[model samples]
Target: MTTETRPPAAPPRVDTSRRTRAPLHLGWWLAAAVIGLTLLNIGSVVVRSPNLDWSVVWEYFLSTDVLAGLARTVELTAIAMACGIVGGVILAVMRLSPVPVVSWAAKSYVWFFRGTPLLVHILFWYNLAALVPAIAVEIPFGPTLFEVDTNDLITPLLAAVIALGLNEAAYMAEVVRGGLLSVDPGQTEAAKALGMTHRQTLRRVVVPQALRVVIPPTGNQVISMLKASALVSVTSTPELLYSVQVIYNNNFKTIPLLVVASAWYLIVTSVLYVVQHHLERRFSRGTGRG
Candidate 1:
């Protein structure tokens, strides 16, 4: 061995084949097959349906009434979500307050609003004037600024806004609270160390940081709100779904008008998806999520 030695012989190469693995998954394949077949069956049924009326869908897609309804839907969504963001922020702040009364009131609001169905909320708003006949702007101890009938102030459209907005507030309150909670406690301490007041720290340091956590869920809520806005039809608001229903009620082209509504919703949702995607990309900079 000493006579034969040159440099130490290189160690034999280890085989890596044993490290490679891909077992056949019969269960996975079977599940995939079932899903594929189910999708195909549904597609076939849609293609063969007798009442689809794709033509009517196309014809009324941009009709005046339909467009107006779509506009109203957009308006409601904007107003509702805006109100939601504001009210949600307030409720979230209240929820985290040091005052027991404030915190309890916030908790109760979230509980009731989230617990009740949105449709009931909308209906109640529509009929709220029956419960409280008048609304006023007054200084509690000093002066009555003005007064008006609740029915006059809360039209069907206003009712829709109030209902959807307040209901959305409850859900959004949780979202906002979660986002705020996700912020590092260290950040708040650091802000305070810099002599920042609580409001200043929240507004300047906490809220901006928390928004990255909040935007995705808020966007999803907006989409859901869009769909839920249709429930306002129950209040006889002439928004998209209600408008479609009115048309179908007049003409007997029930499926066709419904198709129009569906098409519009699809278009709006697709636009929202694109917008949300861009927003996510914008916000996900350091996180590398899209």
Candidate 2:
């Protein structure tokens, strides 16, 4: 029998008439246009203002005094953050402890520190010498075992470090505790079942997993800590803002000096943002948020 070849069937047509176009809201376009124009106008005014003195800004931006102040700011940030991270971990552990008194004490510490402003902490540490002329170590109701002049121990730099570090610890403890809590309860239970001690399980399994949750906020705190280092200028700690203040105080070029300080802050914060993004991506790898 002869086989008949059938003609190829025609391809189906797309339903173009039923296709939907995304909505175009004229109000959104108009609002965007208005905002863009407003920003351009403000920028033009700032860029053209004669009193801003770009020359003065450039002249002192990398001056010796300013560089020294920038170095001080970086040093303080590193040291303070280190202290805060260590103290925060300890406080977070204490806060999570089963012992009622330990948890309550940690809570009280967080409450007191968080309730007080960082500026107050700085001032308090700076003026500690006034409150107590000497720092003493001794038996509670007995003779002093050791004593030292408060001023000798608590210099301006030391005072700034103590203030910034302790204040950061209060905030960081909450961040760490949140991270710890995000960890799955089953992970802890499994580790314990495998003969791991509580501390061992926490250090190995829980903390490693918790890092993914902990890192983003910790990075933000680092950037904030860098900016907050400016507050140390109150105690004449010679950080970035204080250094510029000295320049403006002598030359009376207040706005330009402030611009220089702001420029440095922006540059450093930008770098930190990049680092934080990379870290978040690295930690979020399998989770798909990356």
Candidate 3:
């Protein structure tokens, strides 16, 4: 057999040189064309629009009043978000409580706040003094500890924060509850088996894990809160949009001031977008491929 061995069997051919065309995707081509046209339209508008006063926008973009208003916006967003996060966590805990009354109260809270329009909430909070002129800390049928005038407490800034924070708490509660539900029940059981108390398990084990699921929506809510803070302008709160309104009211430069406000909002939201993306990637670690 060795003496009669033929030349090595010919290698199978792959024909690497011959190129095959990729299958055409009409949907992809249509999407590309649409996007291209949209970009072209935006370019044309930026280049050729009749009445975009770039000079005025540039001049007033960093003016003192606008800066002050922007600062106020940031302050309101931070305070409101802090309040929302704390309150929401409590509400979420209440919703998940073993007691029926606690669960009912939490559900009722979410139902009422989520059912109402945010604008209405804002107006209601801004005008709350009209209904109750004073808020007090007092024992029922006993002496008052302290009292404060509602008007003194509800400054424009405070009103905006209160409205946004309280309203945001309802939504945050649902987000937190959903996140909590996503965690495995077996983990809770295991914690209990390990002799962990309910509060200890929740604080040390549950909430930490739940936060990964909750963060993305929380970021979105933060962005929404940032924009919603502008609605305070209706109450003349002197945030970014209100600052622009003040300028336009004085100089009759409506469009430019709006553009300045728009620019600032776009800038802030873009930064937040980047921050959210990195945070999500961080939290997703060990949960995905190498």
lDDT top scorer: 2
lDDT per residue as tens, model 1, 118-227: 99989998999889999989997989999999999999999999999999999999999999999999999999999999999988989887988998999999999999
Of 1 and 2, the candidate ranking higher by TM-score: 2
Model 3 weakest 10-residue run by lDDT: 281-290
Q: Of the pair 1 and 2, which is ahead by lDDT?
A: 2
Off by over 4 Å in 3: 1-24, 138-145, 195-200
What TM-score would every model get versus the actual structure?
A: 0.85, 0.88, 0.86
lDDT of 2 by residue, 1-290 (tens): 99999999999988888979889799989999999999999998778988788899999988999999999999999999999999999999999999999999999999999998899999999999989999999998899999999999999999999999999998899999999999999999999999999899988988877989999999999999999999889899899999999999999999999999999999999999999999988888788576
Candidates 2 and 3 compared by TM-score, better number? 2
Q: How well is each residue in 1-290 modelled by candidate 3, as lDDT tens digits?
A: 36776899889989989899998899989999999999999989976776777888899999999999999998889899999998999999899999999999999999999998888888888898999999999999999999999999888778888889999999999999999999999999999999999999998888777878999999999999999899989898989999899999998988888989999999999988999888888877777620
Tally clashes: model 3: 0
Error of 2 at 96 (Å): 0.7
Q: What CA RMSD would you report for each candidate?
A: 4.9, 5.5, 5.3
lDDT of each: 0.92, 0.94, 0.90
